[model samples]
Target: MNILGLSCFYHDAAAVLLQDGDLVAAAEEERFSRVKHDHGFPKHAISYCLSEGGITAQDIDYVVFYEKPLLKFERILSSTLGTYPMSWGVFRESMITWFNDKLWIKGQILGELGIETEKLLFVEHHLSHAASTFFASPYKEAAILTVDGVGEWTTTTIGKATADWDGSGENKIDLLNEIRYPHSLGLLYSAFTAFLGFRVNNGEYKVMGMAPYGKPTRIEDVHKVIRVAADGSFDLDMDYFSFHRSTNRAFSSKFEQLFGEPRVHDSVFYTPTTHPNGDHPDWDRDVAAINQNYADIAASIQAVTEDTLLKMCENAYDTTGSNNLCLAGGVALNSVANGRIMRESSFDSVFVQPAPGDSGGALGAALYAHHVLLGNKRKFVQEHAYLGKQYTADEIKNTLDNAGIYYKHFDNDDVMAESMASDLNEGKVISVARGRFEWGPRALGNRSILADPRRDEMKEIVNTKIKFREPFRPFAPAILERFASDYYQLSDAEKLYPLRYMLAVYPTKDDKGSNIPAVTHFGGTGRVQTVRNEWNTLYHSVIEKFWEKTGVPVVLNTSFNLRGEPIVNTPSDAISTFSRSGIDSLYLGNYLIKK
Candidate 1:
């Protein structure tokens, strides 16, 4: 049976195709549309999935949407009504949006796909998040946690899931407890994200990156806005937040009073810690002090978030008594919190899929229908994230030639890996665009910019010159799986799925931090992606060759795109990014182009 899963009308809109319970294709709309965080109906993504699966819309036996639109609309309507006059603007906007497009999602899907009403299905949002991780995981049974900004009426869910790999048991996800909207950990963090001069959904990671520069001295002040219990259940003090009542801001004036003042958006962020030598071009003591306060607020919220997640994981462990945990949803993308969960929680293992946010919900919707709704046994495990479109050597060559680019061609993967490794060793920043693009926010070597991790200056070079992103944002350490444990504090690193997806951060070994200063964050932790040869031979060979050339078994890897853009999807897209960025070299399939 063929199933088509879709998540749209929200950020990271996506589509996935499943053939006989196996994922055939998956991708976010932004990659194809060139709109960062595209939230419209995923027409381009759906078309790509259909083309990748070699099937038309008619071949799809079922069409499942990631969430119940009616239910979500109900939540919005109720919330706006409860807040009354203060929420007039939100209510007006919500009605216009819901009436125009969202409330009619079923019709939209049917009209777009030409499917029968009987073939249409909708799953709850948090359940989709749970299934995204649990069904994709290798574990037959595990504790499940899904946390994100309010999904319908729920914000967080703790549950237990069991899959039928051998058909002896049944596939089930029992979401036993949940925290409702207006009292969300995700929203609490997002408020801080906005206060720290970042976009709410888009800039949460920037807040995470800024946290390491300062201590969590404002933890007490942050606690005043929300209250967390022993079991991780929390409630937001409504007076401190305006997200439910206003469309423009997330935090209220009361929140500003508590946190002093909001940071100016898009302002240069530097602190004494960032520039110990006081060498910043715009070095002003007052501005640095303000930036430091923002960093402290970031740290304080980050600390609270980690502690709350730890409590949630502990509670899930105690309630479910499972050694394995499966995490999904946007909040699961918090690598720092994930690391704390892995190390400090009771679970022995954690599984987080490459795309743990709304995009993964597309896959989860299909999987839920295949396993639970259709009674089909689980058969697929998400071993790697290379599920997007892959370009042929001819396609890449055609694009490069048509663009009038100078290039070289290599017939063997080993030769290409060796050449790229040599380039990286010589301090040349190289962007790799071989194989399929990754399914998540992380590049994961397949679509990554690689540089020598041993050179500390490469951090500044890649940030300012190549990516044009924040200087404080740390690059990932793409390490060979066998040697990951040597540099990072993760035990059995090769077996951990989160490590493979770069979903967790771990502290570097005391003796190894200095060796990879470019990839290590200010706090000495690295978001490590463990690479095995079987996953991507070229990527692994490049890292191995780099290891042979230099003693370190890691390369600094960042997404192969400019700032504020989605990762490149096609060879043409790659070439465009390469031409625009400061990358010294570009590798597209068997072809190489140098500036």
Candidate 2:
């Protein structure tokens, strides 16, 4: 049976195809559309999945949506009503958007896919998040935690799941408890994200990146906005928040009073900690002092978020009594929080699938239908994140030739790996676009910009010259799985699924932080991606060759895209990025293009 799962009309719109319970293809619409965080109907993504699966929409037996639209509409309608006049703008906009399109999502899907009404199914949002993690996990049974911005009505859910790998038992996901809307940890953090001069959904990671530059001095002030209980259930002091009522603002004037003033968007962010030598280009003491306050706010929120997640994990462990935990939802993308959970929580192991946000919900919906709703035994484990579309060698070559680009072709993997390794050793930055693009926000090895991690200056070179991103944003250390523990404090490195997907942060060993300064953050932690040969042979071989040459088992890795753009999807996309950026070389399949 073929199932087509979809998540759309919200950020990170995506589509996934499953055949006989195994994921065939998955992709976010932004990849093809070139619109960062595209939230439209994922028709392009659906087309790609269908093409990759070698099947048309007619062949799909079922079409499942990630969430129930009616339930979400109900939440929006009721919340606006409860807040009344203060929410008039939100209510008016919501009515127009919902009545025009969102309320008719079922009809849209049916028409788009040419499927009958009976073939369409809808899963609850949080349930989709739960299934996305638990079903993809290798665990037979595990505790589940899904936390994100309000999903329909729920903001957080703690559950236990059981998978029937051998068909002896039934597949199940029982979400035991939930926290509802207007009192969400995700939104609370997002409020701080906006206050710190970052976009809500887009710039939350920037806040995470900025947090390490300052101490959590404003944590007490942050606590005034939200209160957490012993079991991790919490309520927001609504007077400080405007997200429930306003369309433009997430926090109220009172919140500004409590946290001082919000940071101006797009302003330079440099603190004394960032430039201990006082060498910043626009170094003004007053500006640096204000930026430090913003950084402190970022740190305070990050600390509270990590602590809350820890408490929630503890509660999930106590309630479910499971040694394993599966995490999904946008908040699950917080590598710092994930690292804390792994170290401080009661669970012995944690599994987070490659795409843990709304994009993953598409895969979750398909998995939920195939495994639980249809009573099928589990057969698929997401061992790697190479589930997206991949271009053949001829396709890559044709694109290069068409673009009049000079290139070299190598048939042997070892020769190409050695050549790339030599480039890194020469301090040349290379953008690699080989095999399938990753399913989630992380680049992994398939679509990554790689550099030598030994030089601290490579951080500035890659950030300012190649990526044109924030200087403070840390690069991931893509290390060979066996050497992960040698650099970062990850024990049994091969067994941790989050490490495979770059979903967990761990501190560099006390003696190893200085060895790879480019990838190590201000906090001394690295969001590590452990590469095994079986999962990505060429990527692993390149890192191994670099290790042989430099005596370091890691490479500085960032997504193969410019700032504000989705990661490159096609050969043309890769070439365009390479042509526009300061990347020294481009690797497309067996072909290499030099600047």
Go through the candidates in order and give each one's C-alpha lDDT. 0.92, 0.93
TM-score of each: 0.99, 0.99
Q: Estimate, for each residue in 1-595, the C-alpha lDDT of model 2 and write its tens digit.
A: 9999999887689999999888989999999999999989999999999998889989999999999999999999999999999899999999999999899999999998898999999999999999999999998999999999978999999999998999687799999999999899999989988899889999999999999998999888888998988888888999999999988899999998898889998678899999998899999998999999899889999999998889899999999999999999999999999988988899999999789999999999999999989999998999999988899988988888887888999989999999999999999999899999999999998889999999999999999999998888899999999999898876899788899999989999999999999999996899999999999999999999999999999999999999999999999999999999999999899898998
Error of model 1, residue 143, in angstroms: 0.7
The prediction achieving the highest lDDT against the true structure is 2
Off by over 4 Å in 1: none
TM-score: model 2 vs. ground truth: 0.99
lDDT of 1: 0.92
- RMSD in angstroms, all models? 0.8, 0.8
